[model samples]
Target: MCSCQQHSTATSVATLAPNGAISFRVEDMTCGHCAGTIKQAIEGRIPGALVTADPASKLVNVQGSADFAAIKSAVVAAGYTPSAEPIG
Candidate 1:
């Protein structure tokens, strides 16, 4: 007997967009290391920040109340270009 039920094996990316949450498109983020670096950079600057980075998409999402400028600065400090896509 074979199971015919369709199931999703793909892992969904959990992005929390609470108040003050921000997402930035990072250029030069080519691998997991880059993602980890970016995550660390932001978390270092803003304690209690939850950062999720997808290297494949070059998108880093931060969930915290940190200042926007500080987040951008952290990206720059990590040697990556931060491109903010305005959310309407």
Candidate 2:
């Protein structure tokens, strides 16, 4: 099982690109269903947005016109906590 319980809160942990692509880490999301829900939530809110969520890596990337705040909210709305991957 993915032990991503270390981070249970949503924090400002995303990178917004010039093209509006976002890449962030969601610590509490640890399964295909969790990823699917997040993907659906984001896509539903932002039409034409491409969202890729990987449970194994705990990373979620969004390619479309979505701000950092919006993506974070979507993850939270899906019942997961998003955060930045801890740096070494």
Candidate 3:
């Protein structure tokens, strides 16, 4: 019997807003090191960017003027996949 759950928990979803806020999924972040890496990667790419990552929610919220492409790239560079939809 396959005991794996096919459902996605709150920690596996990310929400990005049109007001320069981004939220994405990250499953490997377990410590401060991961947070720092993610922040640095995003800030480095977005320049004056603000990011708040909730490991519990697996969501990374970013606020800045960076474009969606850049933001997506930053998230990928940080070792996470950016979701398709941008939350309002």
Candidate 4:
């Protein structure tokens, strides 16, 4: 007999938390390099931006004066799939 099971990927919609903080779910972030690249990409585009990425959870939190579109674009530019909706 064979048992079959399918793994489910968590679905997260990133929205503004507080004080201009946002979280994004990046699917391709699997290592520190990826995280660092993402951080740099975002900070480079948005000055005074703080980015924290968790490879284990595949989530990146950005806080400061940054536009959500740029943030998502930065993740894409850094080569990762990001899932989020900007809080306008």
Candidate 5:
């Protein structure tokens, strides 16, 4: 029960993106390392793009002209499952 409580607490600590940024929920990211990998993967596919993630919130914010499909693909390539909904 303690572990379950801890997990719930951690999940509640995630941060959401500020207004005007494109955001999505990534299901498989469990830590900072996963976030870093996701960021790298996005930047690799779309150079000069900005990517940020809050693992607790399971939210990923990407700043760029890349379409939703490209962003989704990048997240998938980075080993995380990304949803298509934009968190405005």
Candidate 6:
């Protein structure tokens, strides 16, 4: 539903890799504005956190020394549902 008009078939669940990168699938993110808002929310809570949100993919990737709970909480605080992808 991204206003940017781009669409993607990325996975619809969040994942935390061994390297410490966290990936979240936010189905509600539907535009650059939404992405920005999500980014601000995460970055605001987790200092030095790097967030890359793609509305097209409804995916938000976070990198840095951050707690997974904190990251999810920030996103939830911003009013979005972030689903965690299972790690294999």
**Over 4 Å off in model 3, which ranges?**
1-13, 16-20
Model 4, residue 81: C-alpha shift (Å): 1.1
TM-score of 2: 0.72
- Model 1, 1-88: lDDT tens per residue? 0122222222223232555577667756767777888888889988888988897876788886446678878877876667643252
Assess each prediction's global lDDT (C-alpha) against the native: 0.67, 0.71, 0.63, 0.73, 0.66, 0.76
lDDT of 4 by residue, 1-88 (tens): 0012222334457766666688777766777777788888899988888999887787888988557888888777766667767554
Compose the digit string of candidate 5's lDDT tens values, residues 1-88: 1112222212212223565556777766767777788888888898667888887866788887346678778877765677744533
In model 1, residue pairs whose N, Cα or C atoms come closer than 3 Å (at least 3 residues apart or on different chains), thus clashing, are none
What does candidate 5 score on TM? Answer: 0.71
After superposition, candidate 6 runs with Cα above 4 Å error: 1-12, 17-19, 85-88
The global Cα lDDT (0 to 1) of model 2 is: 0.71
Better of 2 and 6 by TM-score: 6
**Model 3 CA lDDT for position 26:** 62
Instruction: Go through the candidates in order and give the clash count of each.
Output: 0, 0, 1, 0, 1, 2
Per residue, candidate 6 scores C-alpha lDDT tens digits across 16-64 of 6566777768877888888998999999999899999997877788899
* Stretches > 4 Å off in candidate 1: 1-20, 84-86
Better lDDT candidate (3, 5): 5
RMSD of each candidate? 11.6, 5.0, 6.5, 7.2, 6.5, 4.2
In model 4, the runs with Cα more than 4 Å from the true position are: 1-12, 86-88
Q: Which structure is stronger by TM-score: 5 or 6?
A: 6
Clashing pairs in 2: none
Q: Which ten residues in a row have the lowest lDDT in candidate 2?
A: 1-10
